[model samples]
Structures are given as structure tokens and as C-alpha cells.
Target: MRRAYSVETVRAAEAALMQRLPEGELMRRAAAGLAVACGDLLRRNGRVYGSRVLLLVGSGDNGGDALYAGARLARRGAGVRALLLAPDRAHPGGLAALLAAGGQVVDGPDGLGVLDLVVDGITGIGGRGGLREDATGLLHTVTRDRTPVLSVDLPSGVEADTGEVHGDAVRADATVTFGTYKPGLLIDPAAEHAGALRLVDIGLGPELPEPPDLEALQYADVAALLPAPGPESDKYRRGVVGVVAGSERYPGAAVLAVAGALHGGAGAVRYVGPGADAVIARYPEALVHAGPPSEAGRVQAWVVGPGLGDGRGAEAAVADVLAADVPVLVDADGLRLLDAETVRTRTAPTVLTPHAGEAAALLGTAREEVEAGRLAAVRELAARYRATVLLKGSTTLVAEARDTPVRVNPTGTSWLATAGSGDVLSGLTGSLLAAGLAPRDAASVGAYLHGLAARHGSDGAPVSAQDVAEGIRAAWRDVRAG
Candidate 1:
């Protein structure tokens, strides 16, 4: 698992560690790492010696880090220049060290004639909103020149805790973060600006708290969570998933959902909806019912919604599934018919899967707001519905009502934006729930496989919903093999 700490937590850990170390030792360690990364980047472009390196220095420790790094580069025969945004507030010690090493300070943007690399130390994790007008203007020139930028910690102007970018922010080709990952580096919108991330350990791990604010699962983690059966296990001993989806108008939704369930490690799939005939045609293995979910016989878990339209039958089916004693997953049209009181009172776990638009409708807010602040929106939805909420998008997040670390899916691709992809995800996750995985684990694992499957299917081209569902088996094998 990849863990990310909030700014407040990171600050506290840094403070605790700094108190125990020598006065300037901590900063020196950070600068050493930064300078090494800069040299490596310069070497990749050409040679470190005689390379033109420009530092965008601000009024904080981030500026100090860049200045000290510039001093190191100067000593190595690189032509280092510092463009101090705040001359009076710059670190005095770092400034003296840079001058001693033959580093020069440029007075204006005109001094930024041509550069091999630009180091962004304009703002640190504590800075909020966006870049100031003066800094933004200077960065425009750098951007125009298409110079590769390396941010000190994170891309300036993005919230380290929430990953929200409100205004103009520096777009770095790469970032060398200190100690550990920040939420901004992992989440989207802000993550889009943070090109590539490298972590330099400064030995602050001992001071940080257990159960970080956010976590992303890697291959081994997903492999452990995947369901496996023994030789003695029978179909019943494994798990059965019940799916209620599709209307006469949208029978394809039911077919896609069943396809996902069949490949999601379930022993059998029992489907109840108006699309029974269509589902039967596609998958004869699936057990079909013509009535409500109550008459669908025994099932370990139920997946409701998908292509269910806004008719009386669809609403009634949703209600019937929600009242069941087994775990239930609601998606698509089912999300529209949800009642807060009914879901909150459920004894079994409930999982709500919604895109940004559906999530916005649930919260009675705008889609733009939910998209911009996905971390907050998903948490709020989980608390409001008292369930495990999966907010699907570029970064699929799974959050529970409890105070556990939110899971951010790292395998998502743009190709998953295809229609019926979400329906497939709903059925897959529901199957995991039937197999006895917790709501959080099921959602996270389902998303991980769903994304990997998309990648396997796409391979860089467009892929359909059926292609994604069919690719799940390959994704499963890949995870287990690892």
C-alpha cells in the first residue's frame, strides 16, 4: 500500500524530527537530495557542468531548499541563477551560500533568456488558493519556452491535503517530494499537474502516525484481497451473486452487468429483471428470474440498478433489493430512487457507486463542485448514506462511514469512460461482497481489477464495455501471478 499523509500531519512529524536533529542538519539533508535530483535531470538533458539552471525562489523554507540546491549545482560548474520572488523574505543563510558558490540572482523575467531546467520553489504544502499574479506571469514565460520544470515538494498552488487546484498552478515535469507522498500527488486534478513523483526519505517516518489519511493499493495488496477457492469447495461453498438490472428499453445493461459478475470470481450469477431473455441469450450459465429480487431464491449478495429505468417496476425492484438481509450494491437508476432513511437503517452493508453527476445529484450540489473536491465529496456521501461509497472517475475513491484511510485507485484509465463500464464495475464489486470481502475492500479491489482489465483490453486503443468485462479474467490472472 502507498500511504499519503496530510499537510498538518507531515508538519507535526517534521517539527518533531527537527527538534532532535542539529539546527541545520535537516535542511542540509533535504538540499542534498534536491541537488542530486537536479544534477541527474541536467545530466539526462546533457551535462551538469555548464548547464543553465534557474530557481524560482519564494519566501519560505521551500525557497531555502531551492537556494541551497542552487548553491550545490553552482559548485559543480553549472550556471545557477536564482529569481527571488520575495528578496527581503528570502533565507539569508541560503542566499550567502549561493553567492559564495558563484550563483547569481536575476532581477527580472528578462534575465530568464534560455534555461535547461527551472526549479519551482514558489510555494510549499502550506500555501493555499493559487499562485500570485507576479509569479504566474513569470511562469508563463517558462511555460512558453517549454522548459522542463522540477518542483521542490509539490506543484505550487495545489492543496496538499485535498488535491484541489483553485487557480493558476505550476505544471512540473516532475516533483521530488520530501519524506512521503502527499494526497495531492496521488489524487486527480491536482495530480494532473504533478507530472512524476519521487520521494526522498528524510527519516521522518518514525514520527508520523499510523493509518495514514489516504492509501493506494499495489499489486501484492490486490493479490491478497482476491478470492480463491479450495479443492473441496463447491459452488454453494463459494459464492452466488444476484443482479437486478436492465429494462426492456436498455437490456444491454443487464447483459454487461451479468458478464462482469460471471468473470468476478463468483460461483454462480442469478439475475432478476425484465432483461432476462436478453441475458439468457448472451450467457446461458446465468440463472434468470422474471419477478422481483425476493423470488430470485438464495443469494449471498445483490447488485441493483444499472440500466433500470424510471418506471414503477424498476423502483419496486430497487426497494425489494434494499430490504434484503444480504449486502446490496446500488448504481445508475437505483441511485435516483434511494431513500436516506432506508439505506441508513440497513443491517447489511450497502455500497453506493456514482459518477460525478450522480454524486452531485445525491448531495444536491453541482457536478463541478464534486469533481473539483472529490476527496471531500466521497467522504460526505459515505457519511450521508451510511455506506461504503465509490465515487467513480479518473481516480476511483472508496470511502467508508468510519474513520479509516480512504482508498484511491491508481489503475484507472481514460478508456473506462465508455458506457456500461460502471455497470460492469457494480456487478464485479457485488460478486466480491458475496465472496465475503468487506465493502471497502470489495470496492477497492473491484476498481483495481476493472481498471487493469480496461488497460488489457485497450492496449492504447478504444475498447467497448463487453471487451472490458471479457478482459477481467486476464487481469485476475495477472494479479495472482504477481
Candidate 2:
């Protein structure tokens, strides 16, 4: 798992690590990494030697890092200019070192010519809100010049912890963060501002806690979580997933949902809805039932409400599935009909999969608010429903009501925005739940595989929902092979 630490945790870890090292040891380590990244970036463009690199310097250690890194670049025969926002408050040691290395300080870069790169050391994790007047103006200058920027730790103006960008901030081409990954580097709006992230270890790991604030599962992690049938395991022993979906008006919903479940680890799929005929037509092996989910025979877990249009029978289907004595994953129309008290009082685990609009309705907030604050929205939904909530969008996030870690999925592409994709996810996750994974694991692993499938299905072209569902088997094979 790739972990992201909260700002407070990172600060505590850094403080502990700094106490054992020499006074300037940590900063030197950070500056050396920053300089290496800058050199590489310059080398990629052409040559680091004789290249012009501008440092947008601010006060505190952030500026010190930029100045120290500038000194390194200057020694390499690069023309390093320091645009000190606070000349008087600049780090004395770092400034003297830069001057000693033949680096120059300039009040304005307006007269400077084209630069290879702009280094943003205007703010560290300590700074909050947005960029100040001086930093903002300097940022505009670099933006107009079209110089690719490299932020020292994080972008200058983003909220380091919450990833809320309230105002103007530096948009970096890449960021070389030290020690650990901060919350802003993983969560968006701020995450979007931080381009390609590169973490440079400064030996703060020993001081930090093992558990992280947020995490994303890698291939090996997913592979371990995936269920593999044993030699003695039969279809029933492996698991059976019951899907209550599709209305007469949207029969394809049942087909799509069943598609995902079939491709998932589930040995059998028992589908209960009005689209029984349609589902059987597409997947003949499915055990179809037109009755309520209560009469659909035994199933290890249940997936409710995909394409369950606001029809009369859809209500009964949702009610029956919710009453089941197994894990339940609610999506689409089921989310619309969900009651706070009912879901909260359930003994079995419940997972709610809601897109921005559905999540908005659940929290009684606007869709825009949910999109802007995905982490908070997902957490709120999980707490309110007392269940695992998967908020799907550009960044698919899975959160639980418990104090467990939140999962951020980074494998998907924009092509997954097509219709029926979410329904496929709901069914796949339900299959995992039936296969004995916990609610959080089921949701997160399902999302990771689903997104990975979409990426493979798309492969740069537009992919339909069915194509993505079909690609899940290939994605599963890749994960298992990994």
C-alpha cells in the first residue's frame, strides 16, 4: 500500500527525525534531492550546464531549500537566479552559500531571458490557504513565461492537509516531496495542482506511525486480496452473489450487473429482478428469478439497485435484498430509496456506491459540494449510513464508518465516465463480499480492478460498459500474475 500521512503526523515525524540529525542535515538531504531532480529535468530538456534556472524564493526553510538547491545548480555551470520574495528574511547560511557558488540574486526576473525551469520553494507544509501577493505575482510571471515549474516540497498555495485550493496556487510540472507523501499529493484539487509526484526519503520513516491517513493498493496488494479457488472448493463453497437489479424499463442494467459478477470470483450468480429474461439471454448460466430477493434462494452476499428505475417492483426488490442476512452493496436506484435508520441498524455489513449526484442526495448537499470535497463527503456518508461508502468519479474513494484507512483508487481513465460502468462495479464488489472479503476490502479491491479493467478496455479509444466488464477477466489475470 502507498500511504499518505496527515500534515500533523508528518510534522511530528520530521521533528523526531531532525532531533537526531545534525542541525542542517535534513535540509541538506532535501536540497540535494531537489537539485538532482532539477538537474534531471534540465538534462531531459537539453543540458543542465549553461541552463538558466530561476528560484522563486520565500521565507523560512522553503526558501532556504530553493537557495541551497540553486547553489548546487550554480556549481554545475548553470545560470541560477534567486528571486527572493523576502530578501531580509532569507536564510543567511543558504544565501551566503549561493553567493559563494557564484549564484546571483535578482529583485526581478522581468528582464531575464527564457529559463529552463522555475523552482517553487515559496511554501512548505507549514503554510496554509493560498499564495500571498508576492508569491502569486511571481507565479504569474513564471506562468506567462511558460517555464515548467518544480515545487520543492509541495505547491506553494495548496492546503497541505485537506487538499482544498481556496485561491491562486502554484501549478507545478512536478513536485519532489521529502520524507513521506502528504495528504495534498494524494487528494485532489491540490493533487491536481501537484503534477508528477516524486518522494525523496530523508529518513523520517522510523518516527512515523505504521498506519497512514489514506492509502492506495498496489498490484501485489490487490493480488493478495484477490480470492483464488482451492482444489477442494466447489461452486457453492467458493461463493454465490445474488444481484437484485434492472427494471422492465432498464433490462440491460441486470445484464451489465450480471456481467461483472460473472467475471468476478463468484462461482454462481443468482439474479432477482424484472430483467430475468434479459439477463438469462446474455448469461445463460445465471440463476434468474422474477420474485423478490427473499425467495431467490441462498447467496453469500447481495448486490442491489442497478438500473432499478423508480418503478413499483424496484422498491420491493431493494427491500428484500436489504433484509438479507449477508453483506449488501447498494448502488443506483437503491441509493435513492435508502433510509438512514434502516441501513444503520443492519447487522450485516453494508456498502453504498454513490456517484457525485447520488452522494449529493444522500448528504442533502449539492453535487458540486460533493465533488469539491470528496474525502469529507465520502466520510460523512459512511458515518451517517454506518457503512462502507465508495464515492466514484475522477478519483474513486472508499471510506468506512470505522477508524480504518480510506482508500483512493488511481487506476481509472476518463473513458470510464460512460453509463453502466458503476453498475458493473457494484456487482463486482458484491461478488468479492460474497467471496469473504470485508466490506472495505471488497469495495476497494473491486474499484481497483474495475478501473484497471476500464484502462485496458479503453487502451486510448472509447470503451463501452460491456467492454470494460469483459476486460475484468484480463485485469484479474494481470493482478494474479503480479
TM for every model, in the order presented, reads 0.97, 0.97
What pairs collide in candidate 1? none
Please list the residue runs of candidate 2 whose C-alpha ends up more than 4 Å from where it truly belongs after superposition.
Answer: none
Judge candidate 1 against the unseen true structure and give its global Cα lDDT, from 0 to 1: 0.92
Separately for all candidates shown, the number of backbone clashes (residues 3 or more apart, or on different chains) is 0, 0
Report the lDDT tens digits of candidate 1 across residue range 1-482.
Answer: 88999999999999999999999777888899999999999999899999999999998899999999999999999999999999999988888999999999989778567799999999978789999898999998866779889999899989999989999999999998998899998898898988878788899889999999999999999999998998987666678999999988889999999999989988899999888889999999999998779998899999999999986688889999999999999999999987878999999999999999999999999999999999999999999989999999999999999999999999999999999999899989989998989999999999999999999988888998988998999999999999
RMSD of each: 1.4, 1.4
For lDDT, the strongest prediction is: 1
What is model 1's C-alpha RMSD?
1.4
